[model samples]
Target: MLKYIMQLYKSKRLKVKHAFSSRQGGVSQPPYDSLNLAYHVGDRRDDVVKNHKLFAYEAGFDFKKLVFMNQIHSNKVHVVDEDSFLVPSCDALVTNLCDTPLMVMSADCAPVLFYDEVSKTVAAAHVGRKGAFGNIVKNVLDVMWERFGAEAENIVVAVGPNIKLCCYEVGEKEKSEAKNLGYGFALSGAHLDIDAIIAHQLQKEGVLKEHVEFLPHCTCCESERFFSYRAQGETGRNAAVIVLEDYV
Candidate 1:
């Protein structure tokens, strides 16, 4: 049995079961080349399903209880308060529901996880250039605070691997757009730092600086290890997921 090597989340304060999947260790073949957790991509349905079961088994969560997002690259956020498998048609999934795992998929895009230990709430969002400029982080935070009592200062965030500025080149118009959005530092000539913009958004919304942690992995440069749509054009997607520790 090929085991999925998980990047399990470790937090001293947040009681949640969370893990980020990489591109290695699974049953998929060729372009997917094993461990592609998304069904929307061109990977075989059976392969994606097998990968999900393996991921759940390796990560110690019930695949049957997971909640997935139908990401649309918009700032729309849906709140989950029940244990169900229905995928929400939104870019972000916010939930205070225990044992109900939330998932967001990505390929050369940022996958972010949020946790509020004080309110025992958790969220997952898929962000690319569109979501980055749309302020998806603020939308997630707003939903968290309004529906659940999650405060910005109490939210702990983790931004997973994505295509960094070193490889995420944009046109002159997009570069100027980023500069006008108060992200001049995200500009390196024609490239934009997508993750940096996301981190800045988190802090701008009152999330504590110490609570934000983003991995330094660049999917485009590390495409051989992690799927990158920007590099491969057509590729499998990696998944970032989170769930409250207590199950109903």
Candidate 2:
């Protein structure tokens, strides 16, 4: 009975399974209450494992085949395969292997999923402010193209929920830094529109506008459904996951 935000990118050439998990429909406690997919955020290990099992069951993937990153807010991209089961220290993960899920855990930071129909590859990225400033999105695209023979034009991206500009307020230093990175700031230099920044990055990398899908929910604003670290201080992490299904 677990609910997920599912996005199926389908074309005549290929199809990819992508899902963004909400804070609902699992067993945990207040703050980490229900469906918390991350273990490092102080959530009990047993609860996290059970939650993953539920998520895997609902999302139609094996929990044992899932690979997660120890996200360090860097631009590092790990090019993985079925044999690359060990968790690595990176912000993004790309793989062409079927049924092996690449997952990114995030609270307020953006969880971006990528799929190239032509190459039948999938990627998941943890794009926080630091990661975005480090150009993680472009790095992921580069890995996809160079390692998996993925074309920019054939890539479809899904930007999952995060802290939008409506509630994401920032100080001058952060705003100035983002501006220095050539990204514009909003709310008169108080808020940063991270989704817009990532979209611009994808476009700059030659990803088509029509192929990029942005989930419009703000994690901080919608605390009832999504866990927001920015709002809750010590919060559990939500996940964005993608897997290439076996071609039939």
Candidate 3:
């Protein structure tokens, strides 16, 4: 049995069953190189499935119960249920059900996992430039609260490896968009600081500053260990998964 190392946050809450996968530890060919978890990235389908199986097994969760997003870069958030249809058009997922792991896959985009110890709810979101500047985080927070009673103050967030200010250079148009959204402070020259923006959004939505943990890794900076679409044009994805604490 292969042991894939899923990066876990040193959260204060030990019961948060979540992880952020790196590009290592699978059987896909180079570039995709071993663990490429996205099926739409043109890697061999079998290889992608095998990668998923490895991830699930290593994380001690059933692969069949892992729910992921189709991810259109929108602010859409879905409340997942046993039979609430296959969510094929959302960038975020929230669930209070145990053993049902919610996942968000990304390359340069941020994969964020959430755990609310109060409501026993968990969520995963794929956050990119659009989502960082848009309402994706707020939307996920809303759905978690409204549908599952997951309070924002009790929500512990783990922001996985992603593109940060050092590598997140943006265009003038996108810069202007962030400015219009009142997040102009996150801009430093040509680079847009996604982490700062997310932090501000979390604070505005009532998530405590101490409860959030931002993983200090840049995919573009560590392309060898983590997948980076910006670094490799036709690349694979890194996945961030969260289940209700220790359901395996």
lDDT scores in order:
0.84, 0.85, 0.86
Clash count, one per candidate: 0, 0, 0
Per-residue lDDT over 1-248 for candidate 1, one digit per residue giving the tens place of the 0 to 100 score: 45555443344334567887888877898788678888887889999999898888877788898889778889899888655446658999988877788888998889999999888889999998889898998999999999898999999998888888899899988888888888889888888888789888998899988888777788889887788888887778888888887744
User: Local error of candidate 2 at 237, Å?
Assistant: 0.9
- Indicate the worst ten consecutive residues by lDDT in candidate 2: 5-14
- Two-way TM-score contest, 2 vs 3, winner: 3
Q: Could you estimate the TM-score for every candidate?
A: 0.92, 0.92, 0.94
Highest-lDDT candidate: 3
Clashing pairs in 2: none
Runs in model 1 deviating more than 4 A are: 1-15, 83-85
Q: Candidate 3, overall lDDT?
A: 0.86
Candidate 3 has what TM-score?
0.94
Q: Cα deviation of 70 in candidate 2 (Å)?
A: 0.7
lDDT of 3 at 150: 86
